[model samples]
Target chain A: AQSVTQLDSQVPVFEEAPVELRCNYSSSVSVYLFWYVQYPNQGLQLLLKYLSGSTLVESINGFEAEFNKSQTSFHLRKPSVHISDTAEYFCAVSATTSGTYKYIFGTGTRLKVLA
Target chain B: SAVISQKPSRDICQRGTSLTIQCQVDSQVTMMFWYRQQPGQSLTLIATANQGSEATYESGFVIDKFPISRPNLTFSTLTVSNMSPEDSSIYLCSVEDLGRANYGYTFGSGTRLTVV
Candidate 1:
């Protein structure tokens, strides 16, 4: 079984400031890590993911996350956030089970970027 | 990545009623996932539907309460039976992006059900 934990329920930051949303997971086997963003009234969009090889993965929108196997963590980071970056971020871990993959998601963190 | 179109974007249903949500994928998929997100919470996997097989449900969910159907490779449906206030939540459908290296999942916009 796999589980994901997001410690911060809400985070507030001013525009152009850096931000990080923490995500930790526990799994018995190798798993794939992903970060998803859900904007207001919109569907979830994939931010970035770490499958293998590279420890760090980046999204086109300037968001990045590093897969730290030692720490069992995949934290999302952005150098500068914009007001439009306000959204709910989720961390998920997918592991193969019964020849199929199952995903476990974190509780989610709400990012609020203020100008 | 496969694109999903989920129907019944939102609805207000009375207790004891049932609502069925649909998902249509742009491409063929071997598996489709259904999830629930309560108010201010993260997503919880409800079940995994596969074509020509019985849907596999999670620990806390049951087939009777949330019946699932997968008639083909590109479509599936989830029905929330015996609705109550506790069942009020956003229901979403998802599919894995086999074409991408990350193997990330694509999600539907979700159906927001408000039980009254």
Candidate 2:
């Protein structure tokens, strides 16, 4: 079984400021990491994911996340955020061998971009 | 990623009633999953809908309460039986499209059920 933990419940930042959303997971075997964003009343959208190879992954919208094996962490970062980035971000983990294809999601971090 | 469409985007039903949510995908997918998100909480996997087989449910969820059916690879239905206020949440359907390396799962717009 895999579980994910997002450290922050809410983060407030000014427009154009940098932000980081911390995420940690617990799993014995290899796992796939993902970040999803959900706007109000909408479904989740895939922000990025860390599968194999390169530990660092990036999204088209200037968001990036690095998978740290030792720390069991995959924290999402953005150099400069815009007001459109304000939404609920979730970190998820799924076991590599588990054929169930179920992803355990974190509590979620609400990013509030103040203009 | 696959395009998913879910019906009954939102509804307010009375207690003891039932609501059936429908999900349709543009392409055939190997796996389809149903998830629930309570107010201010994260998503919880309810069950995995498989064609020609009983849906595999997770802990704390049962077929009696939430029945699922997948007639084909591109379509599935989830019925929330005996609705209660506790069942009020956003129900979403997701499909796994392994073609994309990073984006494997695509989600539906979700049905917001508010039991009164």
Candidate 3:
């Protein structure tokens, strides 16, 4: 079984400021990590994912996350954020096994970017 | 990523009523899933819809309460039976993206259900 924990429920940041959302997970086996963004009235979009190889992954939107095996964490960060970046971000994990792909999502973090 | 078309973006139903949400993928997908997002909670897997076979449900969910149907590789539906206030939540359907290296999942826009 796998579970994800998002440390913060809401984050307030000024435009062009930095932000980080913490996420930790517990799984007995190797798992794939993903960050998804959900804008207002829109569906979830894949920000970036860490499956194998590099411990660091980045999204096109100036966001990046590190897969820390020792810390059991995958925290999303952005050096500067835009007002349009205001949205809910989710951290998810699923077993690396081929057949089963049921994802366990963390409680979402609502990022409120202010002007 | 596979594009999904989900019907009934939102609805308000009376207690004891049922709602059937549909999910249609643009291309063939091997795996389809049903998920629920309760208010202020994370997304939880409800079941895995297997084409031409019975769906596999998670621990707390049941086939009776959440009947799933996958008649083909590109389509699936989930019915929330005998709904109640507690059942009010955002229901989303996802399909596995086989083209991706990680086989990431693509989600629908979701159907927001409100039980009165």
Predicted model with the maximum lDDT = 1
- Off by more than 4 A, model 3: A96-99
* DockQ of all predictions against the true structure, Cα-based: 0.92, 0.83, 0.80
**Cα displacement (Å) at residue B76, model 3:** 0.6
| Docking model 3 quality class | medium
Candidate 2, residue A71: lDDT: 98
Give the residue spans of candidate 2 off by over 4 A: A97-99, B100-102
Model 1 per-residue lDDT tens digits across residues B55-115:
9999999999999999999999999999999999999999988866647899999999999
Runs in model 1 with CA error above 4 Å?
Answer: none
- Give a tens-digit lDDT track for model 1, residues A2-112: 899999999999999999999999998999999999999778988889988889889999999999999999999999999999999999999987776788899999999
Q: What are the Cα lDDT values of the candidates?
A: 0.94, 0.92, 0.91
Candidate 2: clashing pairs of residues: none
Query: By the lDDT metric, which is better: model 2 or model 3?
Result: 2
**Candidate 2's error at B51, in angstroms?**
0.4
**Candidates by DockQ, descending order:** 1, 2, 3
TM-score of 1: 0.97
Models 1 onward score TM values of 0.97, 0.97, 0.95
